[model samples]
Target chain A: MIKVQQPEPYDPLSQVPLVPPPGHYSASKLERVLRKGLFAVTAELNPPDSADPRDVLKAAEPLVEVADAINATDASGANCHMSSMAICSLLSRAGQGSVFQISCRDRNRIAIQGDVLGVAALGVGNVLCLSGDGVGVGDQPGAKAVFDFDAISLLRTLKTMRNEGVFLSGRKLTTPPNIFLGAAANPCIQPLEWRAERLAKKVTAGADFIQTNYIFDVDVFEKFMETLRKEGLHKKVFILAGVGPLASAKAARWMRTNVPGIHIPDRVVDRLEKADNPGEEGKKLCIELVRQMRQIEGVAGVHIMAYRREHMVNEIIEASGVLADRQ
Target chain B: MYAVRLFCTRHARAFESVYKGLEKVFLSLHPLLKGIGYNRLERPVAMIEQMSKGFLFDCKMCGQCVLSSAGMSCPMNCPKNIRNGPCGGVRDGGFCEVRPEMRCVWVEAWNGAKTMQNGLERIRVVQPPVNRELKGSSSWLRIIREKGAMKEASKRQLDPAKSELAQAFAKARKLEPAAVPLAKEPVAALAEQAVKEQTSVHSTQETTSQ
Candidate 1:
């Protein structure tokens, strides 16, 4: 029988019950990662559209052994798919670490609160609070977008829930989610300048760690890190620069044009366009970004955002050489 | 009732400029269009607005036009019609989780707002849900008649305790007036400070226990 602690004094790490509850994941690998001083690698795991647990495990198989934690994206882009919560439950049940994504795009306050309790109950550890993708860009344009709390607010909310052991409504929780809180940053995104300051804001809102948007422009990412360093924001949080393998030069160019925050330099596109094997070149570039990001001062880790094609994750990381001391 | 408070940012300044420019043209043409009052061009105007906006920003003509607030992207085009920021479904490279082929509209809005110089205002404002009655209306006239600012343009009163929109409004109200627009970052700093204090206290307690 699991005993719930009373005379409740909330400690963020008191998440693990004193005794093992039947079968459960060991610990939050992502949490044990010492910020700034240590290097870690996490991968984005896109949950399957089906309810099958094997499908979830199969998708996670590649990175599970390598990544410190695999992010289970919630209904990203407001498109329907498997829920991030389910993926977290399944992954933890399978003894894998997960960063359960909680988006403000769909759930209201009540739902968000319930999910926090639910994840905690399931023994899930890490959570990435996102402002969520706009519903206007999703498959269901007709559905109402719930910005119950934007990323910043969600971070604050989760922090309060854990520390105060109370809901945003001032209601107490029998057991608070002892999560290692994380928030996202889009360093490369425009107005081209406010990105770093925004990251600082995420850290300010109680994000212990940050996972950024794709880092296509090394110069832009470097500048954002510089801003964080200048502000001493680097001392406040662990920043993991986001990196992904681009498909081709054409895709890179298309992304620069049609995509909002992504900015691919002309030279990279030209490099891809000129390459006999653009796909292979893209992987090489991905490796290069990882190595370069590691050299940056503020970046403590890397979050590999490999959408749909997660199979190549190990190969890409191996090529990047970021797995030197990863557990 | 959803109270969509619009905090004016640099993008909103551009919106004001466009509104004035359109008003000048519309006022000059109102005499001409109204001269043929029986055959008003409302339908044609709506169609034109719909077509041009659809092509440019996929405008949904949600009578309370948030184009400027959303960096000229039509909030209606989003599956959830979220105005404040993005959802978790913001896939890699800003792809829409719902429509992998498409780019997330909020992502575009963030870029647009940034490019347009609404730096401090990004993700700070919370847009209220669309009023179905205002569908297919001219944003030009709506701006002139009701909300001088989108913040004032909200049509309903919200209960903060009961709804998310109300809670958002309460939070936004606590920030400095939108004129400063520098309000959001400091508030974020305060929240961060609180967390820091709590963690330090927790560590001290753990040490004492040991």
Candidate 2:
């Protein structure tokens, strides 16, 4: 029989806690992970277009201390980019927390299994499993997809390795990984009901945490939470809302109107239109959105997706009252 | 010739008596043999049997019954026995592990069901867990026989004429030839020789083409 332990009530409006739920991992161990995050924050770091790690490492320097972990994009939307694994290794060597974003596309089950073991061996524990963007949208349009497993299957595979010490093939691991498994969610894409249902599936598949798509509306997010509560999955996993600071109003509008899955509410667009400088206005809007997300009941954290504005992550976190030291 | 004639005369009378008795039994079993509905001899029985097997029943795995939900037949035939889901091993168009022409029965079923109006809603009902004790064991057969007996007991009150088609098919199978007599060795020898000649001629033509 599994023992259930109750966690201490957390205030998301204050300093965000990085602790795993009670009975999931030991409370002491969760405390250790949280202690590591006393001043740490995470920034999504996309890899450079060229093969060299010099430029990538240079780009990641300011984010190293301000952000706890530097998330490396595996293949952001199928475009040709430097390998995430190599960049992660470089970032880790440079004393940055390397959170590797591993996608299911372009890899078969065998390769995926191998990469998981390989990443664990390399001491990169944080992994985000995604059913990546289609090859048609990537730089290599002619390339074929090898969706040997979906995101849920990959999550299940990882959980099996960690908990049962067994691979998907039922082979025993020599040493089981203590990896923190994460997954992605698009709450803004489909009907609120379907989105909730899909999110429930992801949780059931054993996602330790979730990183959502860009947040443009807090009401839609709250509605999503309502549905999640109805489905009885509110307490199961940690949710990190994705927020990106727009470089300009044009970029914000493009993301809202042109992007397939992102929905930017009209109120946000109206606020951006009235501001003196759109970039500054967009940043302020992002900071406000982050502040609002922090007030949410079950949100564990916020994943700031600053697009090309990676440096502003620290400022936004500080302005939102998530980082107390700055205030 | 004289011996053959004597033997035929001696057995003819006995053979006629046996044939007459069998014909009487067959004619008594099915009155429908004389009518227009005669072609449906075994079809109705087969359909009833299939339905009794619970082939169209919803799967027990809930939250996402992708198979019954999708419209594909179950993947219980696959060794892994994945329900409401397909394994990573499925290839293009979601074919099964063993056969290519036969699409992943579950995927095909789901696709077919999804296109139909109100079809997806039918899958929302709960399916009971598979009674594992009734699978791959002798007890299953015993239970089936017991149930069949109970059915027979209840069915006895119905008119015998109502089940005439099933009775006729059973009688007809018994009357049909069980096995054809083997022709003499000369025919087998001729067929084997013909196959060898054809292979040799094909090989020669291929060599010439090369």
Candidate 3:
């Protein structure tokens, strides 16, 4: 890992660390918002391919006002980019809360365990554990795939570090990390009946929240939430539905065919195809989904992944009016 | 191998009972195995394990066998090697995201588990990461040795004498197993070779199935 020194001296007034409220896991704004029973929104930051700090700030410019916390992806889609840890640190320095995403595709247990402490010390508030894409899916297929820990074990390791104050090997730590833990879910995938059970396993392994894959079929997602509600898992962990703009009918079809685990419904594509401006129609669809999802019994919030349509996020959020009542 | 693997999963209930019976046999053979020397028996035991498990499940010999817990499916065959539940990348038809032609191992495991008695309970256990050190070693030998030692210790505890046999057993428990080098190649190299061999074998099976 490349060590980038903190560029400037600390300005305490810019971002004062909040003390965790009673029974709160971390001092994350997102956690506080969720616990308050208010809808929370998290947006993914487009990781810059270069070392410039301005690129990070520029990408975060639109999302800083609307999102409760920004997510820094770790080489999502198995493609190389600036590391999530560095982006988190930069975001933290800029007084914005960031979720540092860690994938088990590249790093072993030793590296991940050490990173838990590193991100915590940097004032990052949340860690999202993911079983990342395979190396074969990436540009660099020759790279060794080191899945030393799957998402469940990764969640377990972090839980051990935070709650037990020890490493996976049982070595003691002076100060355990104080951060919220999250795991990803795909409610639209195969073996739909087992999806809720899998989430149960994740919650048992110490997930504080869950963010799911893109949801185009609300009926299927509703069924998934119904299962979770029946098991009473919704009360255990917060769930944020993944929603995103489709750019155009062509883009929606492309994603349906190429992206794994993402099931874009035929009606959605037909809706996009009928619109004169599919890009605007896509944003409208996202905003509509956000409004609809908030009315669901167990949905805590929406995770809007705009991808290249990042510029449209603020518009979508504002139009959705999900956060209208909040200051 | 693919057909056999699927067949085993479909009959996972019967295989579970068979596996339980074999475990008993292996435990009972511990005395003879110990006399012949476990260190010397590693090669022969590992060879037999590879031939049997390899043909059945295309096993990668991860050494820390969780086949029973995984619904008789070998998780090491997963492209990302996820041991818990299925990843978020299973294709629409329950195929693997990495290897599009192959079924997702966890999907098969879930189906297989549905056929077993205690399948749901067993599959829910969160498995720890693979101990890379245990790769290429014989999981059968490891399980047999561990269970046999445990049984002997319990028997000693039940004895009224509470004599030298108990004390000797207590002393032996703390000692590490003898360091027997099972592979001439580095473990990482061996792992890579195993993966390559699996891919080739799978390709051949794919062709034959077609």
Q: Whole-model Cα lDDT per candidate?
A: 0.65, 0.54, 0.81
Clashing pairs in 3: none
lDDT of 2 by residue, B63-161 (tens): 112232333343343323333233323333455433445454444434444454433452222121122212221211222222333334555433243
Q: What CAPRI-style quality would you assign to candidate 1?
A: incorrect
Model 2 / residue B199 / CA error / Å: 22
Structural similarity to truth (TM-score) of each candidate: 0.63, 0.59, 0.86
Q: Candidate 1: misplaced stretches above 4 Å?
A: A1-27, A254-260, B1-210
Q: List the DockQ of the predictions in order.
A: 0.08, 0.02, 0.30
Model 3 residue runs over 4 Å out of place are A1-19, B150-210
Candidate 3 has an lDDT of 0.81
Two-chain DockQ for model 3: 0.30
Instruction: Kindly report the fnat of each predicted structure, to 2 decimals.
Output: 0.10, 0.00, 0.66
Please give me the total number of clashing residue pairs in predicted model 3.
0
Clashes of each: 24, 8, 0
Least lDDT summed over 10 consecutive residues: which range in candidate 1 chain A?
A: A1-10
Per-candidate RMSD vs. true structure?
Answer: 14.7, 19.9, 10.0
- lDDT of predicted model 1: 0.65
How many angstroms is residue A60 displaced in model 1 relative to the true structure, after the best TM-score fit?
0.7
- Across B122-155, the per-residue lDDT of candidate 1 in tens digits comes to 3445433333434555544333322222244333
